[model samples]
Target: MSTPGKVSLEDKFGLFTDHWSPKIVGELNGQQVKLAKISGEFVWHAHEHEDELFLVTRGTLLMRFRDGEQRIGVGEFIIVPRGVEHQPVAETGEVWMLLFEPSSTVNTGTAGGERTVTELERL
Candidate 1:
């Protein structure tokens, strides 16, 4: 068994530089805590049974929805409710964020395609 310790978001964010790929850092109650670096635009999609929480750590995130979009800045977060179509964009530059969702939640949601990450990497 392993003992609990502290996780440094800055250090974990440094482990990888790839965009759109989320690395698992922790898990609790069937939920996963992930870290990801994002830039450019991501495919529009929706989770059928799970809500997603995106917490901006550095830079900003523009979340686009069918009707409008919400801008998320560092230390702030936004929750995309289940079944609500939305897209994540980092128009300014690279953005760092923490993701909170169900362990079974897929990054690409129901729009599965090339961007779908079937196997997740653990930090």
Candidate 2:
């Protein structure tokens, strides 16, 4: 068995420098909380049956949809419903974000390819 302790977002975010790849931080009730650093544009994809929540921790995140786009800034978050085609972009340098989704959620969603992360690293 393992002992449960408090988690610090700042300390966790400092663990990696990779872009787009998310690192798992915590889990609850079949859901997972992840941290990721992103820059530039990401693949346009949609979760067939999972809703994804993105909470900006640092910098700004641009969420592009078929109709329009939304800017998610620090302390702000956006929830993309299941099956909504969307893309995340960080044109203004690196951005830190927290993602809340189901444990089975894939980074690339339905558009599986090279960017798909089948396994995630736990922090």
Candidate 3:
């Protein structure tokens, strides 16, 4: 009722059909929490301004950064700090990514690689 005051997952899912980009589902203070479906390989990027929190809601996620690579299974999470360049790679499976960042966070804050999340893809 009253427009539900929030959009459902199915409605949000109809908002995008791509990769890398995360769709805003809700917010906490000045921080934004979004859900994104991803596959294949993403670009090497960094926030450079703030830390980023990623949760694997489904499937597995492989995050590779300047240091090394870490495999995150479903129900797992990883935190990447500022200025740390990282790339995300999914192994031929669907993944639900919940990202927490500032309200003005960029998909590729300081990146020069391919597969950037310029817009919501596969929301």
Please give the CA lDDT of all the candidate structures. Answer: 0.97, 0.96, 0.79
- Kindly list the per-residue Cα lDDT of model 2 for residues 43-111, writing each as its tens digit: 999999999999999999999999999999999999999999999999889999999999999999988
Which digits, one per residue and each the tens of the lDDT, describe model 1 over residues 25-112?
A: 9999999999999999999999999999999999999999999999999999999999999999999989999999999999999999
C-alpha lDDT of candidate 2 relative to the true structure: 0.96
After superposition, candidate 3 runs with Cα above 4 Å error: 1-16, 112-123
The 10 consecutive residues of candidate 1 with the worst lDDT sum are 111-120
Task: In candidate 1, list every pair of residues with a backbone clash.
Answer: none
Can you rank all candidates by lDDT, best first?
1, 2, 3
- Kindly list the per-residue Cα lDDT of model 3 for residues 70-112, writing each as its tens digit: 9998789999988888988898777777888887778877774
